[model samples]
Target: MDEFTSEELLEQLQQLDEQPRIEAKRASEIGKSVMQTICAFANEPGLGGGYLLLGIDEPSSVHESFTVCGVTDADTLLNTLQGNCREQFESPICVKGQVELLDGKKVIRLFVPELAPSAKPCTFKGKFDSKNKRKTGIWRRGLNGDYECSQQELEPLLLAKSGTSYEQIQLADAHWDDLDLSVIALYRTLRSKVRPYAEELQASDAEMLYALNLVRKQQDEWVPNVAGLLLMGKPLALRRLLPSVRVDYVRINGTKWVEDPEHRFATTLDLREPLLRLIPKLEATITDDLPRHFRLKEGDTQRSDEPLLPHKVIREAVVNAVMHRDYQVNQPILVVRYSNRIEIRNAGYSLKPEATLGDMGSKLRNPLIASVLYDLNFAETKGSGIRTMRRLLKQSGLAAPVFVSKVIENEFVATYLLHQLLGEEQLNWLTQFSHLHLTDDEAKALLLTREIGAIDNAGLRAITGLDTLSASQVLGRLHHQYHLIEQGGASSATYYQLAPQLQNDDQLPLFSGEAEASSEPNTSDLGTDTSDLGTDTSDLGTDTSDLNPATDTDLPEKLSQKIEQLTPKARRDKLWPVIVWLCALRPYKAEELATQLSRKETHLKHSHLNVLREQEKLIDYLYPEVINHPSQAYKTTDKGTNWLKHQGIEIE
Candidate 1:
């Protein structure tokens, strides 16, 4: 009576290699790992818990396929699993299990529902080791698998259980002087514009901040909380206290991220001003760099100049980034301006599910920040930002912004393309595929995938105005019938990218005349036949060096020895440095790193790679523009190298 059957779960596992909600194991008896997964399922917030399929062996390295090894004692195994769930934890977890047959082999399908928030941070019944200061028994789901929670990692969970947001916590070290008085005055001015007779405007600075819940009294003195400092903190205070609480505006010279460090960015500006000043500054920075156009209205005497991107759209995007960002994460909000698009990457993922982003309800991660922004007319309280951005972009003849929210990675990226979605140039490109007789929506999906390097159901719906089901159907047709695209991920996480043939074909010039007129060097210019480009190999010299050196063979003796000394149950703090060292050598795909480290790919991604890249800024993506690129990999940045050197590790 589960929403998904064992067959469906198995198919997803086989296709995706792993899924957040599905775990398969050949269980002869209830074990530690099984209990840990159960604990993770029960405690992981927003996961809604997960499924455990017993008697199914995981895919092996050699075969890369899952095998159904039937369980001999399903009843006893089920009893033990249920018993452990009831008796082992701080609060009893009620898990449901049923025996199911798959591939003519018996398996136990158990669904563990997440516990209520108040009952969470579910630790095993054990003695507290105060001297060690370690969180021994609490478990949470990670990209690789269930891992014990570290003290630092448990803070958010503990806060959630107490119904206290990180933003509301009063900073003991922050005094009234930390908040900028000029910024508070600016807030008053903006508030008066929204409501001239607003009650808050009549109060003093301290009273106003208290009214906004920005400050709390401690030892009979008003102290700035996180929201207060974020909204009106002096630049020096912000730098000294919340160093990562700022915006990094980077201008890339071209459409893609350049790999060369010397020429990586054309301009870089870091702003640590208060949110009131920072939001407008960010918008102005982006607008000033954008290309402008002239538009003449009906009965207009003269044409009016306007930025290519609508001002309102830019405002909303900027406001949304700062308003709901997770302050606990020590990373700056990154705004990158490329030749063709603008990307805003923030520390926090959307509190709302990705599927429900444009829906009419708001889910605020930082309610205090959101409330302040709302009062000043900077943001809408009803979650109308996405909807407004889509409408404005559509009216302006621009593509709808694409949003990618990674919950496990704790990151959200909003990408706005500078050009029209299906302009004349794209139409000309579509002419080559006219023989396929694609529908208008299908064509849009294809063009979007090509432009962005990948497309998902949500992204397709955004561009083509299709419902979820219709968009999914169109993607399926492209993936299955036409074979123009291939699938990755599974279920709601599924995405489609152009097939290898189409990807290659799209890169080549469509017409012979165009190919001949191309300025770039070609085989024909080298006195070689154009037809020999694909087949000729004898003249191509071989370079034996590794293109991606994130392998066991490439690991340095120091790092290899360090890794060997670590146990399977080592803390993440101990594991992260090693991961950084391995990636420091060369770019490594998540799978490659997992293989080298003997961990699950998803676990490595969620627990280590993402933390390193997003929060720490020690590592970066090889193909940042296309996050789900086929050959996406991670590389250590200059910051990572410096961090290693600071730790007394020599780098080549």
Candidate 2:
């Protein structure tokens, strides 16, 4: 019974909207906004974790000028919405509906949370609605953005929600012996524990089976339901009954389409037995051994068993996928093995809203299947599988498992980082050189630059949760560490990049041997010698093609100082007019610039274009030789004349 006040909920709602993983509906309605926003947010990337504010108006205004336009029928709408949501959503949607008085007006704040990993994206109506169907469809949060689920995505996700197989139904021709006796025994053991009056009901095995709805007498013959056959039927019988409902397993070494895999296995396994077997085998492949003797004991006491994979964590993840996967979706569960990680992707999006992943509650999409698994000792009763996995991974010193629910694609993918496989060298490199001391926002900024090769301040601000000052300090640290090089200015005009010399030595040749000699006034300006890889040729492409060619002689003096002093943007902006005139004679591509200037690809992207635009020194010119619509080149602009004058260039 965690209680959040209306004010708290409003604050949370605002935070969510500011960084929503999905599309947020901008409105002030009470119940309708709550439900629709919850659904839309739930159908967002991770399924759940969203809010609906009743008082806040669209197009945010200052608080003093704000008005709280409350909902009509607040009480009645709250109850109706809660009841309807409970009935409609597969998982119990915990809603905090409250009325708050702001400026003497009553506003209802509804906080709809995301479902647990087990629960998937659920729709209110029992019809197909694609996420892109804007006017009609819905989807949960996906990694990239909101996307409509393909039929292949939707069916399995929905079927998994209830965790029931076709075998649950009583069949007309099946008998007790036709079912797997071992499976039956397991089921009985589970049922006894799950059911309260198991010992009191002194019924025979066949009678117990009948009461459980595994068997039924119809037209003078005993039959099983789809649920009965799927759960308790013999493997051969189950296959014959539902040939399409099978788990496909494929294992490959490395990550490419190339066929040079270290090992590969592909098979269609029976739902129950194969899952049980697959678990152990997957763990075996991912395991490695330590020295076996950390501390020398008297004799054999030094030996210990270490699993290659985090058994308990991976088991729960796989079990959740198997038991709760949408059985209706006939797609295969993919387990992609890579050199460093394992990706287990199942057919279904999370039913819970985005927020539930961080909370301490459970939501079951397939209560029946979950119950069956619980009895069989395959799963827990309290629904803490996700929490358990997280705890275990964290304890094992591995990165927290990444849980993602995509409603648009109708799938749930969990990534498990194999700490053992990362090796001491890789781990040392990542932890020591990875800038771990940096804040989460700072780390994110580094990652963005790493992935994209270049990043502007605005992009850094958006990705890293840093304020202006913090981001600047973080970027400065990266620059100081030689992990990143600044292109452009010290303030808003800056962009950051991985320094070429600091990058792998093998990559230095790509930027070429030509480099501008240190323009540093002395040892103080040149903080460190990064010239080990090669010479510093920062002015390789200086254009003597200035409108007043005589003014170009001054460029040599400007090139004398350290490159850091000539802010990346400033250098480009100041030289934009000269470069544009050079390009006017013969068009040059990005690669050409990089090759001619002896700068890395990263440096070119981070500094070149933005600098050209900053001083208004260049104008766009179409490439006459190319037939491309966007074919353009940079040329001298009228502003270049003034900029050259400012640089103290005299006109002849």
Top candidate (lDDT) = 1
Q: What C-alpha lDDT, on a 0 to 100 scale, does residue 218 get in candidate 2?
A: 70
| lDDT of candidate 2 over 41-81, digit per residue (tens) | 65443433655556554435454322456666667767777
What local lDDT does model 2 show for residue 9?
Answer: 46
Residue 288 lDDT (model 2): 23
Residue by residue across 1-652, what tens digits does model 1's lDDT show?
1477888778766654227778888888899889999989888877788999999887678656778888987888898889998889878998989999999989999999988888888888983354654555888876556777666667888899899999988765798999899999899889989999999889888898999999988888899998999999998898788877878676775555553445555666666789999999778877776766667889999977677789999999999999878899766787888766788988787878777788998999998999999998999769999999989999988878988776555678898987776776788888978999999998988987776567876677656666555677788788889998899854445678888977776441222312233232111222222232233211111111344454555678888988887777778767878888876776677887787777888777887786687546778776554456566677776678789888888778
lDDT, model 1, position 162: 96
Q: Ten-residue segment with the worst summed lDDT in candidate 1? A: 535-544
